[model samples]
Target: MKQFVFLIDTGNETSEHKIHATGMTDALKRVQDLKNHLNDNSNSDLKIKFKGIIYENAF
Candidate 1:
């Protein structure tokens, strides 16, 4: 199995980030959709960057 870490940053005056990890191919692609959904709901004047995944260890 492979692993991935998604570093999400909501660029703002107060920069914040969260990490999510998964091994599923479908889940990895869903990050973009989820991020978009979140952006639409938030009233914040900021945009979040969906940083690419980081592979950890060999299969």
Candidate 2:
């Protein structure tokens, strides 16, 4: 398995989330699900931005 890191930026603060998957395709699906989940549960005044995904060991 591989590790995928996602940066969530909400103007004032930034947060990191890690997802473990078999490949990029699976990782991306999980990321999208995360975005949808956040959007669904967040307040109308709050905005969520996804900076990008970092692949572990890609460097």
Candidate 3:
């Protein structure tokens, strides 16, 4: 798995997420999942500013 730093900017607020995924595809899936969760619970419209893998295990 890899570690990712995701920056979500909602017009009014900004948040960061540390995610673990195997690859880019999975990382995107995780972001979508997070978007869905936020949409379901929050009222603001959030947008992703930066999404990239920060670190990977040396295994």
Relative to the true structure, how large is the alpha-carbon lDDT of every model?
0.54, 0.70, 0.82
> What's the lDDT for candidate 1?
0.54
- Candidate 3: give the clashing pairs: none
What is the overall TM-score of model 3 with all chains considered together?
0.79
Per-residue lDDT of 9-54 in model 2, one digit per residue for the tens? 6556677888888877997799788878876877533344444555
* Poorest lDDT segment (10 consecutive residues) of candidate 2: 43-52
Strongest candidate by TM-score: 3
Sort by lDDT, best first: 3, 2, 1
- Residue 3's lDDT within candidate 1 is 38
TM-score, every prediction: 0.39, 0.67, 0.79
| Candidates 2 and 3, the one with greater TM-score | 3
TM-score of model 1 (CA atoms) = 0.39
Top-lDDT candidate index: 3
Which ten contiguous residues of candidate 3 have the minimum total lDDT? 50-59
Residue 24 of candidate 2: its Cα lDDT? Answer: 76
lDDT of 3 by residue, 1-59 (tens): 68877899878888899888888788889889989998998788888855667666565
> Where does model 1 exceed 4 Å of error?
1-3, 13-25, 43-59
RMSD of 1: 4.5
| CA displacement after TM-score superposition, residue 51 of candidate 3 (Å) | 3.9
